[model samples]
Structure formats: C-alpha cells, structure tokens
Target chain A: MGKILGGDNMKIVMVEPINISMMKIEEYRQQLEAEGHQLIAYSSRAENDQEMIKRVKEADILIIANQPLSAKVINASKDLKMISVAFTGFDHIAMEACRENDILVSNSSGYANQAVAELAFGLVINLMRNIKDSDGAVRVGKTRKNLIGNELFGKNFGIIGFGSIGQKTAKIAAAFGCNILVDDHKQHKLGEELGVEYLPIDKLMQE
Target chain B: MGKILGGDNMKIVMVEPINISMMKIEEYRQQLEAEGHQLIAYSSRAENDQEMIKRVKEADILIIANQPLSAKVINASKDLKMISVAFTGFDHIAMEACRENDILVSNSSGYANQAVAELAFGLVINLMRNIKDSDGAVRVGKTRKNLIGNELFGKNFGIIGFGSIGQKTAKIAAAFGCNILVDDHKQHKLGEELGVEYLPIDKLMQE
Candidate 1:
C-alpha cells in the first residue's frame, strides 16, 4: 500500500447523486479529506455503463444509490476494493463481479424501515376508510351516505415479511388494537414478543 | 308505574329507530315485556314535530337516537320521567324541558370513541403520506415527482380534545412514536399517566 501525507488515503468516488445537496457533499468531502481520504462526488447520474466505468476506474471505493453497476463497469474499476450502496437493496450492484474480485460490498439497510412502515399504515388506512372516495365526495359538497368505513380496531392484520419494516408495521398495527398475524419463512423472536401469531402463508392469507 | 301481572311496569317508548333492525327492536321489546314493561318502538323516524310529540305523549321513559326532542314534544309527554339517548351528544334533546319536567337524561357516550379515534388516525395518515393524491396519480398513470411525504413517526401530534376520543388518539399516536401534546379544558390524570404534555388550547394550536 502506498502512503499519503496523512495516511493511506482512499480515492472514494460517488458515481451517482444520492439525492443529497452538492453543498452537503462538499462538507462530507472536506470531512473525509481531513481524515486522510479523497472523495469525488457527482451531482448527476452516469448516463451509460461507459460513463460509470470512467467515473469509477481509479476509485478505491465507489458509492452508489440504486444506479445499476454492471459486471463490465465493476471489472473496469481495477482498484475498486469496496462498494457502499446508499440504498436498502443492493440487487442493482454486480454481485458476481464483486465476489470474483473479493470486493467488499455494504448497503444502507434499515434506513427506510420506519418510513416504509409508516407508508404501509397510510395505505391500509386509506383503503379501510375509503379516504379517496370520501375526499372526492366532500370536494363536490356531497355527504357520505353508505360510505361508512370500517375500523382497524379488533381486526386481524396479516404481514408477509418479518423484517425491520414488517416488525415496525406490526408495532403500529398492535397499537391500533389489531391482532397481528405474521407469515415469514423463519420464526422471529421479536414477532413472538410482540404477541403475533405465526401461521403458514396460505393460512395467513385466509386469515 | 302501573301494577301488572309481572311487576310495577313503566311504559318504555323508543321514538325512533336507533339504527337497529326491526327484529332486534322486537327482541328488545320482548325482553322488556318479559321484565313487565310495555315497549312501544317506532321503526321509522318521526318526520315532524307533531309526530315526535305524539310518539312521546303516553311514554314514561323515552329512548331516542339523535332524533329531535323539542320542548314542545317534552311538554306533551305527561308521564315522561326518563330519557335514554342512543347517541353521544344530547344537544338535539331539549335540556331545559328535561330540567323543568324533572326527567333523567342519559346518553350513550364512549360508544363511538374508538371508531372516531381510528378515523382521526386514518385522516392523519392520509394527509402525512399523501395517500389520496398518490392513489389519484397512480390511477392516472403519473408518478409522484415532488410528492415526497413526511412521516408521522417522531413527529408532534397535537390533540385538541382530551375526551375519550382524544385520549384514544394519543394512545395510537404514541404507538406510532409520536410526541403527544394535548389541549383540553381540564387536565386528566390518564393524560399524565400516558406521558402526554398538556398545553393551553392556543399553545397546542401553535405546536
């Protein structure tokens, strides 16, 4: 490994914008530079694989956010040692190339767990209350006649996945006095602690 | 009270249908009759003041559900002693008349507390996540460009009334990890137990 003035400074290149402001990226760059690291942040996405390759060729570490990293682009980065994905899912990355090259891959998981859980409740409430239809009716100065909506209380709320998002959703559903029914491949201790009943996927669907 | 074969039986008249079926009302009437009371139930709503006055004239106890019970109707009821309202609010009933006639007035409060609280959350979730707008957009085949929404988690949820509905609302909001700020005319011990911060109505409005 070659030594820089402060330490072994890595050339970290962010191939695509991660929805952060340029000023914020500059602040991050300054902080990293102070710690003996160099950061190259792009304000825009790479239009093509060639552009992606060009941006990541000399990077020791690459940062991306749901931008597809093909094997070709991954192979082009000869010095790439690690990839830091700014999204919960890393499927957009070339796992095969990273495995062959022994490049370490990390993702920003659990970041959107609360947000996703909240959205799940939002969608559930919308359907249960017929909010869209009610909103439309009120806008036209009409009253809800037979549009009396059902309540979530004492209802059986079934969740398919038992991940962070699912667990958070269950917590909220439980708060609303729902009997939670989970259908996950593996039994989670948290689900049990939450007083959730686990059933087969088919049974859960029926429930 | 008149002495019947069963016991001292008072005339119980249900002036209007309380959203219950005729069969259910008949069942109730049979049960009341079995207890030595004569129950006269009207399946339909009284359309006019005259109809309402006529319905209650011979009653000892009246049961109503949001149907207007004017002072004129109350005055016409010579044997009226008590009123059992099937709704949370009794403003539609003549309080002055009941006071003057020495009639006992009771209401079915807390019945719709959970339903109203759940609907409060439904409306909150809908607004926070833009569910209605998103639903509309999806139906029109348009993407949410700048329609990114705020999450209710870790947000301040201020409630105006600290009644049964408001307390239930605070419970659900707390479950969603919100900081509950309540503003009511009186401070409740339950609110304190729930770790809610009480504020003046004006102050809570600002929050």
Candidate 2:
C-alpha cells in the first residue's frame, strides 16, 4: 500500500501545525506509517510566491490553515493530490489550477456554525445590554452609572447570509423572539420554513 | 389567575415601547393575549422623574428593556411585584430595592450562550488568521493577499466562567480540539470531568 501510494515510501505532508493540544499528531503519524503512509509535518511560512511553490512541491496531502495557494504553486506541485483546508471558506485556494491538476480540495464546514451564530447573538445582546462594558466597570470596582442596554425580544435581526451558519444563527436568534430578515443570492424556501422575511441584498444592507 | 397574581382585573403593563418593529411586537402581543393576559403595552418616553415613577407604579409586572429603575421608583411602587427584564444582566435594576420590596427580578440566561461562544472562537480565529479582513478585501474585488489565520487543531482556550453558558461554550470549543482552561468562582469539578486545566482567576486572567 505504501509502495502504491508513495511509489516506494511516499509521505503525507501537513503544512504548519494543528493547534489542538489534546489530540497528538504523533498518534496520527504512527497510524498512517503503520498503514504504509509516512506523515511529514512541517511549519511552513509560505508567505511569498517562491515559498508557496516550494512548500507545495514537497507534499502529497497538504493541510493548510489560512494561507493562500496561488496558481503558480498549484501548477508546480507534481505530487499533490489532496488539499484539506482547515477553514470553512475556500476563497483562498486557486480553484482553476486545482481543477486543471485534478487535485481534490475539501474544507472543514458546519464545524463553527453554532459557535459563530452564538457569538453574533451574544455580541448583539452584549451591545444592546452593555453587559461586557458594565461587567468590566463592576470588576474594576466602579459604581455603575447610566448603564442601560436593550432587550432582544421582538427585535429585528438582519441576517446577511442564509447559508448553514447564517441559518443556524437565525434559528438561535428566533428562539430569542427576534424577527429575522434574511438576504441571500440563492433563492430558496427557507424564508417560509423559518418564517423569515426574504429581502434583496441592497434592501438588507440598507436596513 | 391574573386577579390572583395581582388584585381584581389587573393588567400587565410594559414601560417604554420596545425598539423592535411594530409588526413583530403586534405578533408577540397576539401570542401574549391568547394566553389570557391583559397586555397594556405603552410606548411612553417619560421625561421627568414624576412621569417615570407614575408610569412604573401603574404596572403590575414591569416588562422593561434598557430603562433604568431607580430606588425611589421601586420604593414608591405599590403594585410592582415582578420585573421581567427583557435582556440578560440585572445591573439596571436597583437590586437592594427589589430585595427589600420582595420584588421577583428575573433575567434571561442560557439564551445566547451558543451564539456568544461561537463568536468568541470566530473572533479568535479571525484575529489569529485575519480571515474577516481578507474576506472584506476579496469582497471589494482585490487580489487575494497573504493573510494567515491560526489553526484550532490544538490551542489553549482559557474559559472565565463555568456556568451553563460557559460550560456549553467549553464543550463547543473542545469539539474544535482546544485545551480547556477554566477559572470559576464556584467550586465545581468541571476541570477533572472535562479534562480542563482549572486555574486560579488571577492566573487565568493574566494568560
């Protein structure tokens, strides 16, 4: 299997490092090695064109964080088969080059949906109620004065995007009794399902 | 039920009008009224102390958003029993007055936990990797720049509070492969159970 995949001991190279402390990459390395696939993990600051190309040329499976992969780098990589992005958005990858090279690229999605949506609502509430700022004042032993924030109940929530993250955000916001106004380029029946008012981008932005 | 809660034929009066849209409020009002509660919703901007005190004194249950309830107002109120705060945080309420008067003060908790935590992670990732600014540049039709974000595959996440919301936040952060660091005033065994490093508040805050 190792010979077939790497042509006599080829390796899977991960760019930079994963920031998780609980899961050791060594365990993954050993498992892959046992299965006849070697794992080569390196911290590559592939900032410029030359560095990007150099890093891509030396890998089989490349896992990137937020680094942009240019067309020049994608074309230079002869052995690169898979590019697993560690984020939801894939706007950083050179899609045209990947298509030409037949390189499969996948990204982590629906992972941070709940987290992002939760935070947006939290921010809105914090801003409305002055929780953080007020809390900060109290923590510093200051007498609370003129601290007032608004309630989210029956409030207007203008959702910019209606994707998985956006929808999840809308759902949570709805639970808080917020009237959602969603705007998406792709037309769908989510508005009817979620009871959200669908608006054009222009109108939504204006709102 | 209404008469028992108050006296005879008493109505639940809201203070100033909520800043939400009229259509949304009307929908909520219909739901509340369907439950057999007399809703005397007012949108008054009481200018003087006399007007504010009068407005508050008339209500049985004061459903308030961000309006300040002074000690004098609470003391003067003969009918006020419950202060149903529309948002989380009770800093606006004169807590001493409420306690002395036997007024039941309640605030919404666990409403926006998931949303807030998710945003915190997003903010961490975006700040670490510069995703939002990069996306902003791309949206304005700029060539993709070399904006790097950190991977959460293994990182130290120091959680301040270990309440329901904080615990939920930690769980979601844990899913992202973060090493949890908790600092709670309460004597809870979340650290041993969740594999989180329980640190002192001073230490955690410094980090």
Best of the candidates, lDDT: 1
B91: Cα error in model 1, Å: 3.6
Compose the digit string of candidate 2's lDDT tens values, residues A61-124.
Answer: 7888777788888899888888888889999999888888888888998877755765565456
Q: Cα deviation in Å at residue A11, candidate 2? A: 2.7
**DockQ value of candidate 2:** 0.05
Which 10 residues in a row give candidate 2 chain A its minimum summed lDDT? A1-10
Off by over 4 Å in 2: A1-8, A21-23, A140-143, B1-207
Task: Give one digit per residue, the lDDT tens place, for model 1 in A1-207.
Answer: 221223478999998888787889999999999988999988889899888889999999889999899999989888888898999989989899898877889899998898898888778877887888888899999888667788899999999889888999998898799999998889888888879999888999998
How much RMSD separates candidate 2 from the native structure? 12.3
Kindly state the number of residue pairs that clash in model 1.
0
Each model's TM-score? 0.79, 0.51
lDDT digits (tens) for residues B1-207 of candidate 1: 221222368899988888788888889888888888999988788899988888889988889999878999998888888899999989999999888888889899988888888888788878877788888798899988667788888888899888888888888898788989988888898788778998988897888
The lDDT of each candidate is 0.86, 0.71
